[model samples]
Target: MGKVMLARRAAIAALLAMRRDDLFVVTGLGSTTWDVASLGESERDFYLWGAMGGAAMIGLGLALAQPRRRILVVTGDGEMLMGLGSLATIGIQRPKNLAIVVFDNGVYGETGMQPSHTQAGVDLLAVAAACGIGARLDVSDAQELHALAERLAHFGETLFARVHIAADDPPRVLPTRDGVALKRRFRRAIGIAS
Candidate 1:
């Protein structure tokens, strides 16, 4: 597996082991990283539009609505940068039930080749920490990720994990589903049917 996928898969497995039935996940296109890692019968996966940066906000809503439940947001670096302001809101809210994980592959993988904010020298963890969310960086192997997962279980703070995903082209798993169809499915997946 590629770097980003590897890290995400590890993280996903960790999330699954920690919480299965009482969790919420906000995920975008690049979430194929974690999707491939998810196991049988999980209704908690709230699929998101490629509407980059919206995932975290969605996670925030879920956390706020169900303040006692844990919410995890798996997003791409490109998408998070698109909605960086969401971090500020999350910071102010300080929802202890939320964790935001950004897979920093440094490219807008869904689109044609283009650099993301991370590639442009943006330290998202620093930016997030400045916004008041607890931030951490993961660059080591699977053991470190497992340890992080254990830590995630006990932290009652808004957490941000910036994972340095290896630079790889986005994976092709669902065949090239049309953009419109994908959006519709995503809306349904997240129960935002309109």
Candidate 2:
């Protein structure tokens, strides 16, 4: 209820630390991608360089394709808002292995920190619930982050969480920009035999 919020980098670090080794990650364009790559680039990570609103859908496809592995989509509030319809589609498909986490700093970090829909008082958790997502988690602090991390490690159903973070710009950590190499690496990581 106050101005205090989680640090974006720290939140990503904590969540990734709790993530299971095989949990496939699909990061939205911009900040979230840098946040995850800041930790360390991984072949399991399919970082979206330009798909502004396709992270959740990609996660859904991955979940459906690999039912045995977990899929986590780490995206920003701006990207999530752009891909709002994907939530409904995900709900319809109901991939039990997929989870979406929105880092809500309340602004478009990729652009110029302009206020986003979430900053305009949109309740993303409610949106996800109304869209038929099975689990809704609102995380703002350390305890809640821990709880969410635990659930992510052993998730049993479709999950959507909004993590409130500070709208501060940390130094960007750029990863490989070669989409072709990234695609090949990710495919090999998932054992596509190519």
Candidate 3:
């Protein structure tokens, strides 16, 4: 198969643009974090700087705790691969308001651009399906991405998608690194006692 046509920044911008006020976003470390912060910081956005493989689990926790709000977990293929078991856990938990979107550029963009398993033919969509996530998608074009964007707006089921983006690195857009402050801000935004 030929390579995917989507650009990482464009895809992320499109996705975040569709986010509603109640949407809770958790981004994985490295490129995905940068991609999210690039759209401007938000109290609803929790950017992971160190927990390399825990984004989805954190999203799951938030989804369970705040069942009424939509939760979106955005991460890169490399990070997702490191925490592959989270998929099965999420599949079992099956939060109706949770969605996970993987930016699969087929490389570990932060670690010297090493080729990832996605580049070696590991299909994440298939894994999600096998893990029992009912709503799974593999996005490679603008139309499909738009469709995914729409679904994210009114999410009602556990959703997973691996978006194939270009391998080129974009300028980093870093968020605040203070975990305590981020936690307090996120709690306040969600109306929880910090």
Candidate 4:
């Protein structure tokens, strides 16, 4: 598997092991990478449309409402940079249940090969820390990443993880469901309709 795929899988495995029914997963383009790693049944995985950074904001809402539940957000590096401000909101609230995993490909692969904030020295882990969230970086092999994921999972603090994945294109997966449909299903699963 590709580096991004490996990282996503490792992250998802860590998440699944911590399975809590109340937890929701807010994800974007790269979520499929993690989904492939997730076993059997999956949680509410929000497939972001063209909107970037949307997953993080949505995750914030879920975390706030269900303080006892964990909220895992799977997002791309480019997407997270788009709404870095949301980190501040999450930090101020100090929600212990929010965990954000950013698959940093160093480029906006989903929208063509454009450079990402990480390519420009935007240290996302540091940015998240500055925004008041506990953060860390994992750039080694899959084993190391899995270890880091374990450390972050039950930290009981808003955590941001920057995973340096090899920059590459993902295998084209068919969009079985559009954004609207996915949103509706996700909302129903999370007991939130809009």
Which candidate achieves the best lDDT against the true structure?
A: 3
lDDT of model 4 at position 44: 65
TM-score of 4: 0.78
Give the alpha carbon lDDT tens digit for every residue of 105-165 in model 1: 7787777758877888898889898998765656445666666667567657788887666
Kindly list the per-residue Cα lDDT of model 4 for residues 1-194, writing each as its tens digit: 24334444544565456555666777765544335334543436665555666778888887888787778787888888888888888778878888887877678876677887788888888888888775555544666676655655565777777767666554554443466776677778877657
Candidate 4: RMSD to truth: 3.9
Clashing pairs in 4: none
Q: Model 2, 47: alpha-carbon shift in Å?
A: 0.8
Candidate 2 Cα RMSD after full superposition onto the native fold (Å): 0.9
- Candidate 3 lDDT: 0.93
Candidate 4 local Cα displacement, residue 145, angstroms: 1.8
lDDT by residue for model 3 (38-143), tens: 9999999999998999999999999999999999999999999999999999999999999999999989999889999999999999999999999988889998
- What are the models' TM-scores? 0.76, 0.98, 0.97, 0.78
